[model samples]
Target: MINSTQVSYFILVAYFDTGALKYLYFMIVMSLYMLIVGANLLLIVVICLNRSLHEPMYLFLCSLFVNELYGSTGLFPFLLLQILSDIHTVSAPFCYLQIFCVHFYGSVQFFTLGVMSYDRYLAICHPLQYHIRMTSSKVAILTAFIWLYSVLATVVMMSLSVPLQRCGNTIEKVYCDNYSIVKLACSDTTVSNIFGLVYIFTVIFGLVILILYTYMRILKVCFSGSKQTRQKAVSTCTPHLASLLSFAFGSFFEIVQGRFNMSRVPIMFRIFLSLYWLTCQPLFTPVLYGLNMSKIRIISKILYLGRRM
Candidate 1:
């Protein structure tokens, strides 16, 4: 058995022979990737270029769109290449890097969403002081914290994982995950596994609580406040609620897949489950936000129509 040092590459066992359909799959994936990039990038550019969109909410959204690009770029390009290639093997170093990017994407997603929730809470619950609390500098600091925190966490996870001695080099999924890599280790992983659980709970559950609490408070205000306030809350918070639900769906399946034995599930379905968040969330968020947020929708329409500035 080849240990990690000797294992130059990892065989992705999930990919099967699609024969003539490989091209079809490639085309489908490539199109989705392009659409994701275009949609997210459009919103990012719109937010950055237009002075009207320089508010706290739009700024948070800009950070989000940028992350969608970051996450999708990490997965989609590698996926497109794998779809077309006969061999689904990834270099060991590349596998670790993919692990980092995918994890980093998720970490940032949850953290950003948590912050977005707080932003909404401020807007709805304390509209009078929303600007006072979420000043431009504060938004910049929060945005920086989101990325920086995710980086430090991902880096720590990667550092622990990279030194492990692998007993095998086969990963059962189309992509590499830290857990899957840990399962292959020939060395002791007690410390790694423990840290992994702590890391996951600290990030996931903690942020989940924050999101839940923020929305709860926001809801309380909407109920007791004026009609206009209720309308404002609904219009502003609907997209965020949808986004959280969408991500929760993907995240649930991901957790189930990662922690449980899922051989009874259909292979195609399982594959879809794995790809749900990485593919669907990235594609879903921009579309959801773009269509739902009127200001963004109008600007996007204007840009698409080539209207004069």
Candidate 2:
């Protein structure tokens, strides 16, 4: 049996010949990558530099932006190189590393969003106690927990996959996927499969439920409250809901891409769908939170347009 040590490289089967169009593809992807980096960085800096934005919500946003940059950076540079190269293969070690990063990013994204929802619920539903409950130190502790938990869980999952007896080195995607790697293992992958399912249910589905439940509570408060309360909920929760839905849509397709057969679909469309999961949400979050939230907008204007807050 060919184990992971024997399998030095993995062929990414998603890429097809684009010939001269590769230059066009390269420019497009490079531009997208740059934009993701620029937008996320701008927001991160705005959140960091402004004393007014030192609140819990903005702090959480900074974490979100940083995670976006992390996730995209993990994928895009290598993706750009792969697009231009005639060969679309990655080393086994780097592939596993990419797997770690992508999974960590995803888990953290779900978690941070969940925490942000809880923050909002406190802000709107229990305004008086919000500050006391979610103090700066608490936010720091929570943020640390999110990153640490994701790392420890992902490390355990990777340990299971990396040493397995690999029977193949072909991953039919534009990037490394842990499930794909596990599928290549000649040895049993029952443990990995169970852990993956448990992780998804607890992290992905659990967060979705949390977000939904928090919104439900907020909505109930708004219905009986004054116009100002309703408006506040709309202003604050709209972006969060929009973010959750957009990311969910993208994530659904990604899960499908990994688990289901789509061989009949056109290759180009499949590739775009795969990349969409990582691209759309990163762009959406900065725009939604940065522009849609008035405080961020005012502060961003001050920094970028030389206005005073």
Candidate 3:
């Protein structure tokens, strides 16, 4: 149970001054939110309906899309409301729930990406073993483990955060982020900070390095294969690799910038980084998987034509 002080609600300070800017911000963010929700939901539905997309890679991608939808929703809707209205306050219980969902879903996504990297590694480097190793049952079990791990990790993090006192309940950002939430705590957060650093290194950084290494080995093996086989393999992987690079490198640089207290950087740069993390995950998740899937592309085209008609 969270202490009363720790459970205190927060009021986010909106950035807009003019009523016109507020309205514009509301419309833009609301539109983006709806787009993210609709696109991800559509992708999930299409993937489930199409038997051709039942492979482990598509399965992992679908899981990632779902996580992005949940992760973004945890904060976006409330923040959108705050942007439009003068009231930026959130209830204490709701705030903690938001924190839990954000962390849990985000971690699940990281794990799913790790799973995707391994799937690609097997498909590219060990084509003979891919079928045996990534059977439907094994994929299902791996996905289950990812979700369970995410839940356990979230429990530990949420428990650590529950003791902080939030007497002055004001946050600078548009959303309830971990750094901002931890900063307001009256209790000593030294242990939490240390734990966060450890978690970041072990889970986030370590997984990223492992993914890169696996991909490199896969690439080497792919290049050594017959030309036709190599071309086919590259076609299957190149898009996913590009998407991963955009996601990982962009996030890494932006996080380093923000963590180093580079907030004094241009407002446009700050907003770009904020929206990059906010929008790209949802936007690219569906697009990457959909593009890689010919069946999905045909279905999307049919849907678009129907809408137009």
What's the TM-score of every candidate structure? Answer: 0.96, 0.96, 0.88
User: What is the descending lDDT order?
Assistant: 2, 1, 3
Q: Per-residue CA lDDT of candidate 2, range 14-104, in tens? A: 9999999999999999998899999999899888998999999999989999999999999999999998999999998899999999889
Better of 1 and 3 by lDDT: 1
* Model 2 lDDT at residue 294: 87
Of 2 and 3, the candidate ranking higher by lDDT = 2
Q: What is candidate 1's TM-score against the reference?
A: 0.96
State, as a TM-score between 0 and 1, how close model 3 is to the true structure. 0.88
lDDT score at residue 129, model 2, on the 0-100 scale? 100
Residue pairs in collision within model 1: none
Clash pairs, model 2 backbone: none
| Collision count for each candidate, in order | 0, 0, 0
Better of 1 and 2 by lDDT: 2
Off by over 4 Å in 2: 307-309
- In model 3, the number of clashes is 0
**Candidate 2 Cα lDDT to native:** 0.90
Error of 1 at 139 (Å): 0.4
lDDT of each: 0.89, 0.90, 0.76
Cα RMSDs of all predictions? 1.5, 1.8, 2.9
